[model samples]
Target: MTAPLTDDEVGKTVVDAEGKELGIVAKVNGSRAYVDPNPSLTEQFMASLGWEGDDEEDYIVTEDMLESVGEEIVLRGEI
Candidate 1:
């Protein structure tokens, strides 16, 4: 089991295995979070922080993907 992360330690840079910028942590909703990946990537992004439809609509990223948590937001390798 992993220790719980705090809100203060959230918003950190999420880099890939090769140290590539993915995105910044937006917010944590439930068991997942909203990772706004870099615009350069072709992946779609959420317009805001909330639910939309059948899909979570918030770019639901799991905590396991988290690479590091900072004073601002959480960081994940990829989502």
Candidate 2:
């Protein structure tokens, strides 16, 4: 497994393997990273496109989902 990103990586941009922008690191606590998810044009737009799982839930960027850490956080899988 890959090593987790540090809590200090907050505010860094996060991207998926396909290089799709996920969001920015909001807070990192233990094994989870709270992300200020990428903006959706509107609530309806998010629902219409189904950007991801659940929009209401808080996003946590865990180590398991992480691929690497650099100027920005790189996620493990494709978008």
Pairs in clash, predicted candidate 2: none
Write candidate 2's Cα lDDT for 1-79 as tens digits: 6666655666667788888887766556778776667643453244234332333544877787878888778888742
Extract clashing residue pairs from model 1. 9-70, 10-70, 10-73, 10-74, 11-73, 11-74
Per model, state how many residue pairs clash: 6, 0
lDDT of 1 by residue, 1-49 (tens): 2235433223434455466666644555555655555421223232232
lDDT of 2: 0.65
Whole-model lDDT for model 1 versus the true structure? 0.45
Question: C-alpha displacement of 65 in model 2, angstroms?
Answer: 1.0
Whose TM-score is greatest here? 2
List where candidate 1 sits over 4 angstroms from the true fold.
Answer: 39-58, 67-79
The C-alpha lDDT values of all candidates are 0.45, 0.65
Error of 2 at 63 (Å): 0.3
Error of 1 at 47 (Å): 14
